[model samples]
Target: MSKIQHFAFLLVEEFSHLAFSCAVEPLRIANLVSGRTLYDWSFGSENGATATCSNGSVTLVHYGFDAIPKCQQLFALSGIHMRNHVSKPLLAALRRERARGTRIGALCSGAWVLAEAGFLKGMQAAIHWEYHDSFMEGFPEVNLVRSVFVADEKHMTASGGTATADLMLHLIERDHGYDLAVAVADQMVYNAVRNATAEQKVSLQSRNGMRNRHLARAIQMMHDHVSDPISPALIAEDIGISTRQLERLFGKYLNTSPKKYSMEMRLERARNLLIQTESSVTDVALSCGFDSPGHFSRVYKAAFNVTPMLQRGRID
Candidate 1:
């Protein structure tokens, strides 16, 4: 039998409980299915013997940042407000682990911590899609993809949630054999496992529960041009359909007009920027294709029932 591989996870404050379970359970299942000690795992935190997740569940850890032990691989796991939790001690511990030649990875917003430590610069990485806008604005040096996971880089990353399970299954296959990985996945009743190339977001077509190619193309166009929204006529023309037909498609499938749908898309992006990034309101307005901050504020209030400034203030 191959020698056992050891893994350690440094759980950040308010980490995702779902991602935590997904990351560790596959390893446990792999050992059970193979009837061998294929892998072992431990947890560490910045302080104390327990770390709390975003859902208020507390987990016991084997070490703190001050006492991280040697392990074959170390992954940083985090969730919302991850930026606030990237402490000096955490960076120092990661740097020390790197100096010791340990393999490193991240899950969810944990990429923010590694990027802040200057390890993800000039490397291709993945983070949860909710953080895409803020992460790009913060770490332009890092080539961030929308993939569910990235395992080819020196530092691996999973885009949080069940994507961590996909990454774990991939690693199991890589370290042992494909048969064992399949068995582990079967044991978990996870049949729809995605590869690393799979994107983090479900397609608009899937989410809308429709199969109209033209509508899908139009929705994709709106998403791609959130910062410079085009008219519905232009989108219809680009998608090789008449404006009337485009309206009909939207009315039939989404029960909304094309123009209104596009506006909602831009507004949603604006809300994400308002909460996730430190960009000014005017900047956020302009970035989401609004010509004036006053108009943006009025429209935002209509849609979300709060002004941009007040929304941001509430979060702060």
Candidate 2:
């Protein structure tokens, strides 16, 4: 029998419950399927206080930052507004764990905390797609990729949600064997498992159920040109579809016009940059391809109900 490997998780305030459950459940299933104590885990918190999840659920911890127990691996689990939980003491604790040669990783937005601690500098990592722009802008040195998870990197990163389960399964496969990973996955009844290389974004086909080649091509073009947005007419012409047909496709599937979709995409990136990076509002506006800052602000306010200026102070 292989030795029991202990894993510890440090939960931040407002951690995503789904990510946390996904991270731990795989190990539990691995043990159940293997019929052995192949894995063990415990939770930790910054303080001795209970950690609250994003969904308002509370988790009790076996340890605190003051005394992070020795373990084979440790993961930092966080979610939205991850920066608010980052602090010098937390970074120092992670450093101590690393100094002791403990393998460390993150689930979901926890990579943000890892990057903030300088642990993931110069390494490839996966963060949830929503934060990709902000993470890139904030941590320029960190090689962020659009994937469900990154397992082989020095520090593993799961983009969060079910991706955490995929990462845990990958780790089980690496440590034990493919059979054990598959068994664990089967026990969990988790089909449709995705590997690290899978793109994090939902494909247009899967999201909209629109298999129209023209629509796919048009959407791809929009994604490719967010920073230098092109006109809907140009997109329609290039994709060999009439502008009217293009609008109908979007309206039928996405319930929005092409112009609205494109604008929403750009605004989403702009919001991410505003909250995740130090870029000025004008720079963010330009990067998102808004010619006029006033126009960008109006659109942004209308979409988010908050002005870019107000969002600027949100970066941690």
Candidate 3:
């Protein structure tokens, strides 16, 4: 049998409950399925106060940063306005653990904190898709990938949700065996388990409920050019499809026009920036490809029923 592994999850305020639950539960089931104490886990907070998640749920920690114990590994779990929660103290604690030879990793947007501490310089990391734009803009030294997770690349990083479960399963498989990992997954009823290299979101074929490669490529292009968005016609041409065919593809599966999808994508990015950064509404508008604040305001208000100004300070 492999040695028992101890893990610590350091929770930042506004962390994702889904990510946290998915992370801890997989380990629990690994023990249950294996019928051995294969893993142990604990939670910590930056302050003694309970860490509140993005969904407004609270989790009591075993201790604060001052009390984090030596473990086989540690993962920082955070989401939403993660920029607000990262502190020098937390970074120092993580660095101390790394120096002691603990494997450090991140769940969800926690990569932002690691990058802030210079732990991710020149390392390929993954954050939740929502944070990709701001993270790249802020930390140019970190190589950010769109994968759901990256395992054991100096430091592991998972984009969160079920991706956390996948990472834990990968560890279980490596340390224990593939059969044990499959047993743990069976207990969780989590079929279709993904590997670390899988992309963050559901595959477009399954998610869009279709198998149109052209449509998928077109939408991916839209996501890639949030700020400097290309027209739907350009995307279609790039994908080797006529504009009309692309429009039909979008209409059939997404129930929206390509232009509308692109607009919503840009608006969603705008919202993320406004919440996660101190950028002014004008800057957010420009960064999201709006020609002017006035145009962005009108579009934003139409879609979300509130002006960009009102949404600027809102988190999550």
The prediction achieving the highest lDDT against the true structure is: 1
Q: Per-residue lDDT of 1-316 in model 1, one digit per residue for the tens? A: 4989899999999999999999999999998988899899999998859999999999999989978888999999999999989999999999999999999999988888899999999998988877766787788898887678889999999999999999999899889877888888889888667667555556674543346789888988998899899999999899899999999987655546889888877887787788778999999999999999999999988876678998763311
TM-score, one value per model: 0.68, 0.67, 0.66
lDDT (10s digit) by residue, model 3, range 1-316: 5688899999999999999998999899988887889999999998866899999998988988778887988999999989888987788888888888888999999999899878999999988876765777798788787667889598999998888888888888888887888888888888656655455555565563346788888888988898899998899889898999998887655546899878877887787777678899999999999989999999888865568888643211
Question: Which portions of model 3 show Cα errors greater than 4 Å?
Answer: 202-217, 220-316
> Over the stretch 216-269, how does candidate 2's per-residue lDDT look in tens digits?
888899989998999989999998879999888876544457897788778777
Best-fitting candidate, scored by TM-score:
1
Model 2 deviation from the true structure expressed as Cα RMSD, one decimal place: 16.5
- Sorting all predicted structures by TM-score, with the top scorer first, yields 1, 2, 3
Sort by lDDT, best first: 1, 2, 3
Least accurate 10 contiguous residues by lDDT in model 3:
201-210
Model 2 weakest 10-residue run by lDDT: 201-210
Superposing every Cα of model 1 onto the true structure, what RMSD results?
16.9
| Candidate 1 Cα outliers beyond 4 Å, as residue runs | 202-217, 220-316
- Measured on C-alpha atoms, candidate 1 has an lDDT of 0.86
Could you tell me which residue pairs clash in candidate 3?
none
Taking every candidate in turn, the Cα RMSD to the unseen true structure, in Å, is 16.9, 16.5, 16.9
